[model samples]
Target: MESTGGLRERKKLRTRQAISEAAIALFLEHGYDQVSVADIAAAAEVSKRTLFAYFPTKDDLVLHRIADHEIEAARVVRGRGDGEAPLDALHRHLRARLAERDPITGLCDHPQVVAFYRLVTGTPALQSAAARYVASGEEALAAALRETTPGDGRFAEVTAALAAGQILLVQRALAAANQACIARGMSADEREPDALAEADHAFGLLSGGLAPYRR
Candidate 1:
C-alpha cells in the first residue's frame, strides 16, 4: 500500500509539472491574460478538470513558487544554530543561494523564464498575488520569532515583523538588480559577482544594531 501510495504521489507530481510547464509555455507564447485553463490543459494533454484539480486558478500556475516562500524565512529563523542569530542564518542562507545560482535571483535569462518574470512583475494580478505571499511571509516570520523568544511576547513579535520586512525588502532589491543585469544581456555567472556584492551592500544595512532584535 505504501509503495502504491508513493507511486501515486510521483504520478501526481509528474502530472502537476507537465501542467505547469504547459501553462507557462502557452502564457509566454500568448499573453498570460490571453491564455486560458482550457488552453493549458489542451497543451498538456490533460482535461480541464484535471488541471483544476492540480491548480485551481491560473495565478496558481504562475505564482506557485512565490506561495512557497512564505514559510522559508520563518524556517530559517526557527532553525538557526544555537550560536547563530536569525539575521546571520538568513544571510548565510542567501549567500549560499548566490553561490548555488538559485532561481529566485532572476539568474535564468532564458526567454521563457524572462517572460515568466515579466509576466509576474508586469501583471497587476500576479503582482497582487506575490504581495500577498510576501505578507504571509511576514506573518510566518513573526510567528516563528514568537516561538523562539517565548517570554517576551509583544517585543519578540515586533522585532520579528521588522526583521521580516527588512529581509523581504532586501530580497526585492536583489531580484531587481538581477533582473536589470539579465535584461542587459548578462549571463547568470557573469551577473553573480556583482549581484552578490549588491546583495551584501543591501544586507549590511540591516545587520547589527540597524534593526536590533527587540526581544
Candidate 2:
C-alpha cells in the first residue's frame, strides 16, 4: 500500500497532467491567445484558482513540459565524471539525448512533440517566455562553469559567461535545424546520422575556441 503522502503526490501529478493535456488540446484547436484560464479550468474540470495553484501562468501550461531541462546543462557540468572536461561531458550528453530522440534535442518526430514545437514557436508570447527559460539555463550553466574554471574574480566570471553563451547558442542552432527537418516530415532515425555529425562538428569548434575555459 502507498503512504498517504505518496497517494497525495500521485493525485497532484494526475491533476497537473489533466490540466496540461486540457490546455494543449484547447490551445491546438483554438489558438493559445484565444484560450483563457477559465476556459482551461473548465476543460480540465478544475476551478480557475485550482489551475493557478498548479501553474502560476498560462505559459506554464505549455512550458512545464520542458521545465525539467532548464537546469540540465548545469547538472551535466556539476556531475561530470572525474577528469572529464565540461564541454566534453556536455557533448557526450547531447549525443546521448539525440540518440534517445529526446524532445529537447528537437529530433523527436512524435506527433505530439512536433505539435508542441509548432505551438511554442508560432506563439510570440510563448517565444518570449521560452527565452526567459533559456536565459535562466544559461545563467545556471555559467555559474557551473565558473566553479570549474580556472582564474579568479571577473576574469573567471566573464569567461564562463562567454563560454556558456557560445555553448548554448550551438545547442539552439542544432536543435532548430533538427526541428526544421522534423517539421518537414523527416523521421528522427533518418535525421540522427546528420544530427550526430553536426553535433560533433559544433562541439569540435567549441573545443578549439573554448579550450581556455574547458575545465
Candidate 3:
C-alpha cells in the first residue's frame, strides 16, 4: 500500500492536472486575458482560494509548464560529462531534444502543443511569463557558473552573465524559428534536420566564444 504522504502527493497531482487542463481549455477558447482565475477555478470545480493556494497568480495557471523548465540550464551545467565543455553539454542537450521533437524545443506540432504555442504567442500576460522563465534560467545558470569557476570576483560574474545570455539567445532563436515552421504547418519531424543544423551553428558560435573563459 502507498504511504499516506504518497497518497496525498498523488491527490495533489491529480488536482493540479485538473486545474491545468480546465485552465487550458478556457484559455484556448476565450483567449487568456478574457479568462479570469475565478473562471479557471470554477471550471476546475475548485474554490478561488484553493486555486490561489496552488498558483499564486493568474499567469501561473498557464505558465506553470514554463516553471517546470526553470532549472534546466543549471541542471545541464552541473550534469555535463567528465571532460565535457559546458557549452558542448548544452549543445548536445539541445540537439537531442530537437531530434526527439520535444514540445519545449518548439518543434512539436501536436494539436495541444500548437494550441499552447498559440495561447502563449497571442497573450501579452503569457509573453511576460515566458520572459520570466528565461530570466530565471539565466540567473540559475549564472549562479552555477559563479560557483564552479576558480574565482569569486566580478570577472566570474560578468563572464557568467554574458555566457548565460548568449546561451539563452541561442535557445530563443531556435525556438522561434521552429515555432515559425510549425506555424507554417510543418511537422516537427519534418523540421528536425534544419533545426538540428541550426542548433549546431548556434552552439558552435557559443563554444568558440565562451570556451576560453570557461573553467
How does candidate 1 fare on TM-score?
0.89
lDDT of 1 by residue, 2-119 (tens): 6988999999999999999988888777878899888899999999999999998889999995676668878887788886777677777787877776667666667766777888
How many steric overlaps does candidate 3 have? 0
lDDT of candidate model 3 versus the reference: 0.85
Cα lDDT tens digits, model 3, 1-215, are: 89999999999999998998999999999998888888899999999998988888888888998787787878988988887767777888888888777888899999899889888888887897788888889999987766667756657788898888888888988998999999999988888889999898887777778964343
Per lDDT, the best of the predicted structures is: 2
Order of the predicted models by lDDT, top scorer first? 2, 3, 1
True-vs-predicted CA distance for residue 103, candidate 3, Å: 1.1
Q: List all candidate RMSDs to the true structure.
A: 2.4, 1.1, 1.6
Best by TM-score: 2
TM-score of every candidate: 0.89, 0.97, 0.94
What's the lDDT of the predicted structure labeled candidate 1? 0.79
Poorest 10 consecutive residues by lDDT, candidate 1: 206-215
List model 2 lDDT by residue over 29-146, tens digit each: 9999999999999999999999999999999999999889998999999999999999999999999999999999999999999999999999999999998889999999999998
The CA lDDT of each predicted structure is 0.79, 0.94, 0.85
lDDT of 3 at 180: 90
